[model samples]
Target: MTDVTPTPTPTPLLEVAMPALLRHARHTYGAAMRAALAARGYDDIPANGLYVIGALALGEAPLGQIIRELRVSKQAAGQLVDALVLRGYLEREVDPQDRRRLTVTLTERGQAAADTQREAREGIDGALLACMGEEKVLHAREVLAALIGIGREGE
Candidate 1:
């Protein structure tokens, strides 16, 4: 009996470098975002909570829709909504068609929070873009578009 060893393929640049770069980018971006939010009296809210607020700011959505859009567990999404509700950032309304179904909407406070966060994010993003240069940023966006196309090929 002979045993055969499979030959290893050379690692692709995107495969090896992209994961780390993406992770670092997420971490760095998240930290900067958090700091910006904190500077505007939003430090009490959790990061996920802010996301919920932002999502609701777009329009009134049911709890289930928010959960699905955010891709979070029901319990986690519920907890986040609950916190936002307690903090006066959100309000729960009974769906007109179904009383049993609840919809979450941002209150005035939530809208303010979302707007403040958006402004902070824009400032941070603008600074990063300025530093990276418009050309490089455009090139990076093109590369990401290519990656997205490749990723969708299997689907």
Candidate 2:
């Protein structure tokens, strides 16, 4: 008397390295967002500027905080900020609570671009949800957050 079941075959996805998977996944979002922004006449946004814009849209985070998140050198961060300001996507203003400090805020054009970027991202999210279902998508987020936390642990 025997009770036997067949072993499952590994999927092709299992063959790909984690880093490669992450890079391509990022490219998917990046391409979608860039195309959407460009279609709306925001083609001039500098590299990594989207991250700055998106972070600011979330809240009034300090430039230092954005720099840390970007993991870019201080000089690079300074250059990024300068480009964004010059591009009319950001404006330097006196900090309301700290009169001695200057803060950067998004201009009207920046808001419009942010909105377009967000919609593009949401479109990808919606597609993921539709294909993967809610439970699977939530699990994917959990896995990604854990991976992000691993990087943070080194700091």
Off by over 4 Å in 2: 1-11
Question: Please, what is the whole-model Cα lDDT of each candidate in the order they appear?
Answer: 0.76, 0.91
Clashing pairs in 2: none
The digit string of per-residue lDDT tens for model 1 on 41-136 reads: 767786577667776776667456767867788888778778888888888889899999876778887888888877766776688798998888
TM-score of each: 0.71, 0.90
- What tens digits encode model 2's per-residue C-alpha lDDT throughout 58-145? 7778777987989899999989999999998989989899999988888998888889999999999999999989999999899999
* Backbone N/Cα/C clashes per model: 0, 0
Supply the global lDDT for candidate 1. Answer: 0.76
Please state the error at residue 145 of candidate 2 in Å.
Answer: 0.8
RMSD of each: 9.6, 2.3
